[model samples]
Target: MVLPRNRDYFQIFLASLSPMIFVVLLLAELGLEWVYSLSIITLCYLASFIFWFKNGTKPAAWISKGKLHIRDGVFGTDVIYKDRLESMRYEIGHKRAVAGSNAEEAEMHILVIKMKGFDEWTLPIKDLIEHGPNLRLYKFIRDNFYNLKLVKK
Candidate 1:
C-alpha cells in the first residue's frame, strides 16, 4: 500500500509566518504608519508562501514490490530492498515553538530505517498541527515486513 506524505505546506507556511501577519495587523490597527515595514514583511511572506506552495506536497515514502521507496530529502528519493534493511524503528520528538510566543511546542513522530550498507533514513510521519503520528503506517510496516528487525529507538 502507498501512504501519502502527511504534511500540508500551506498550513506550515502560515504558522511559521503568523507572527509577521500579526505584526501587520497590529500596525494597521495603529493607523498604518509602519507601511514600509508592513509591506516588506507582507511581501516576504507572500514570496515564501509561493515558493513552498510550489515545492511542497512531496517527500512520500511507501513499500511496494518488497522494496521501500522513501524520500531522502527535499528533492531526492532512495530505494532499499527488503533484503538490505537492517532494522526499522520509530520515536517521538518535540519541536520547539517560537520563543516568547504563545505557541506551544509540537510533537513530532519520526520513522527511522537502517540499512546494511547505508546510513539510517528518517522520515517525519507526523509534524506540526497538520496531522498526527501515522501509527497505521508503522503498524503496516511491522506487520507486513515481519522478517525485518524491529528495533527500539
Candidate 2:
C-alpha cells in the first residue's frame, strides 16, 4: 500500500493560475476599474495557492496483517479490513459543472467501496491525484479483493 508522489509544482501553479486568468478576462469585459480588478484577481490567486499547498500532498500508506491503512489528511485516517470489504468498483465519467455556466465542467472518476455492515464510501480519486496512478491503485484493490458487487444507479 504505497502511495504515489505528489503532483509537481508546475502542475500546481497552472491549476492555481487558471482561475485568476478567467477572473481577469471577465473583469476586462465588464469594464471594471483596474485597481479593483487587480485586487480581486490577486486575492483569488493567493487563496488558491494556499489551499493547494495545504491539501495537495499524498498520505502515507501502511499495510497491517489483514487491514489497509491510508492517511490523506490531518484528520482521521481510513482503516479498512481486508475481509470485510464486500465490493469495489470504478465510477467514471461523472460530470460536475462549475458555477456561473454549464460550459465549464469537471469530470471525476470515483472509487466506491462497500464494506460488510457499513455504509458505502465514495472516494474522489481524480481530484486528489493524477488519473493514471489512481487507476492503477483502483485496479490493484479490485484484483486483490474477493467478491465485487457493483452497485447500479
Candidate 3:
C-alpha cells in the first residue's frame, strides 16, 4: 500500500531559523556592550538549531493490509500490530475548576488505546502533528482501523 507524505519543508526551515531570529532580537535589545548576553544567545541558538534539525518536520505513516503498522519517531519507527490494540477512543477535555482560577479549562484531544494484555497507551494528536496537513494521518488511522474498540468511562 502507498503512504502519503506529510513533510512540510517550509515549517522545518522556519523552525530551524527560529533560534537565529531570537538571538538577533536579543542582541539588538542588549547591545554589543553586553558580550555575555551575546554569548548566551549564541549558545541558545545553536542548541535550538540542532534540536529542530533533528526532530522537526518528520511525518508519521500508518498502513494496514493483514496487520496494522504505525511508523513514527525521531530516532526510530514504532510498529504496532492490529491484534495488540484492545480499544481506541477519542478523548475530549472536560471543564474543570483549577486552583486560583475562575474559569473552567479543557484538556487536549487524545487517542487512548489499550493494548491487549498490556497497559493502556495515550497518543496526543496535537503533539504528534508537525503541520496542518499531517492531520490527515490521524483521520486515516481512525477511519481504517475497524477493529478499534472504544473504552467506556
Q: Tell me the lDDT of candidate 2.
A: 0.63
Error of 3 at 85 (Å): 1.8
lDDT, candidate 2, 104-126, per-residue tens: 98766566878899889986544
Q: Scored by Cα lDDT, where does model 1 land?
A: 0.61
Q: Would you estimate the TM-scores of all the predictions?
A: 0.43, 0.48, 0.49
**lDDT for each residue of candidate 3 in 8-71, tens digit (9 for 90 to 100):** 6676667767668667886788677667876877688778767866665434554655454444
The Cα RMSD in angstroms, rounded to one decimal, for candidate 2 relative to the true structure is 6.9
Whole-model lDDT per candidate? 0.61, 0.63, 0.57
The number of clashing residue pairs in each candidate reads: 0, 0, 0
TM-score of 1: 0.43
Candidate 3's displacement at residue 121, Å, is 4.4
In angstroms, give how far residue 131 of model 1 lies from its true place: 7.8
Scanning candidate 3 in windows of ten residues, the lowest lDDT window is: 125-134
